[model samples]
Target: MKGMDVCFSGLLTRAKHLADAGENRSDLAFSLQESAFSMLVEVAERAMAHCDKKELLLGGGVACSKILQEKCRIMCEERGAQMFVPANEFLVDNAAMIAWQGVLEKRKANKNYDEWQPNPQWRTDEVKVDWR
Candidate 1:
């Protein structure tokens, strides 16, 4: 996990704990959320530049955070870039999404099927995927 991811996770856990404790700290909750958003925006900016991609696509479970979504929007606006997010149903963990991505990967490989486990350590940038 990246530094931003760790920070965001910690903030989110703290926020959830506070919310569950029946402590109505809207201001604090919002602040924590904003911090998480800031971390994501920073990570996204660095990632986009590293990949030389004018537009960055954020996917998976974390993309559903409304705060993060807004942050990403603002960050992209500042840079005159764009961010793409998949539908909510597709963002979370689902067999269809996994199978779909696997099919695309298999197509790229252009080889026969072979049983394999989905790598828990899969790194997006390290994978050979031809999204274009």
Candidate 2:
């Protein structure tokens, strides 16, 4: 489908091949992590540049990775940007961020908010955020 999906599929195929070849699992995992995180950092750098943003805020479970954090910090430093990462406790999937996002959504919602139904499969780009 999308270019990213294809790239990810290729990565998975490569990882599977490595495993099937009886490669050391730890080494394979490390290689995969490095490749994935490098790609992520590249994409983040592009996005920051495209948006003319000087601040990088990382969240979610992946943000908890020390390697990823370091990569982000390096990118930020190179770009003279500020990187903000929550404490480890808040880096992973936690209810506090969800609650805070809900609070923000509720505040932005109009009178039609009650009619909005939660779609478990909702995609970030699919929703039309009129609340903004």
Candidate 3:
């Protein structure tokens, strides 16, 4: 997590420098996004290797980026793994996914729905998969 913070900080610093140098906003944005997405893919690859997992699922708003999708696809192909990315509409935060996941979990067993408060800033790793 600390490494991720540092990586993002570096991207922000680079972006600032580029902006101050009068670089095109689009170029700066793309550069930062590419760097950040590259880091994300690297970490994902490591996680897959560590867990011996052959499937990769990319979601969230960042997954909508064509560049990220392509990079992840190539990475998965190189590793002989399957990569799943939802459609653009589902790539971002959507209630449908959340509701579907909740329904699936509910079907497994009785979960403490009362304890599941909505968290706008929730991170995927932060959620405890008690059903699992």
Query: In TM-score terms, which candidate is top?
Result: 2
How many times do residue backbones clash in model 2? 0
Query: For candidate 1, lDDT tens digit of each residue in 34-115?
Result: 7766777898888777877779787878788877888889888988898898889878756677789878877777767765
Please provide, for model 2 over 1-132, each residue's C-alpha lDDT reduced to its tens digit, 9 standing for 90 to 100: 232221455676788998999989899889889888888888888889989999999988889988999999999999999999989787777678678777777778743667768764455567676545
Where model 3 places Cα greater than 4 Å from the true spot, the runs are 1-7, 94-132
TM-score of 2: 0.65
Candidate 2 segments exceeding 4 Å error: 1-7, 94-132
Lowest lDDT 10-residue stretch of candidate 1: 1-10
Candidate 3: give the clashing pairs: none
Model 3 residue 128 CA deviation in Å: 14
Among all windows of 10 consecutive residues in model 3, the one with the lowest summed lDDT is: 1-10
Write model 3 residue lDDT over 1-132, tens digit each, in one string: 343322476578779998999999998988888778888988888889989999999988878888988999999999999999878887776777779889877767666788666654465667777656
Residue 24 in model 2: lDDT: 90
> Which ranking of candidates, highest TM-score first?
2, 3, 1
TM-score of each: 0.53, 0.65, 0.63
Full-model lDDT, candidate 1: 0.75
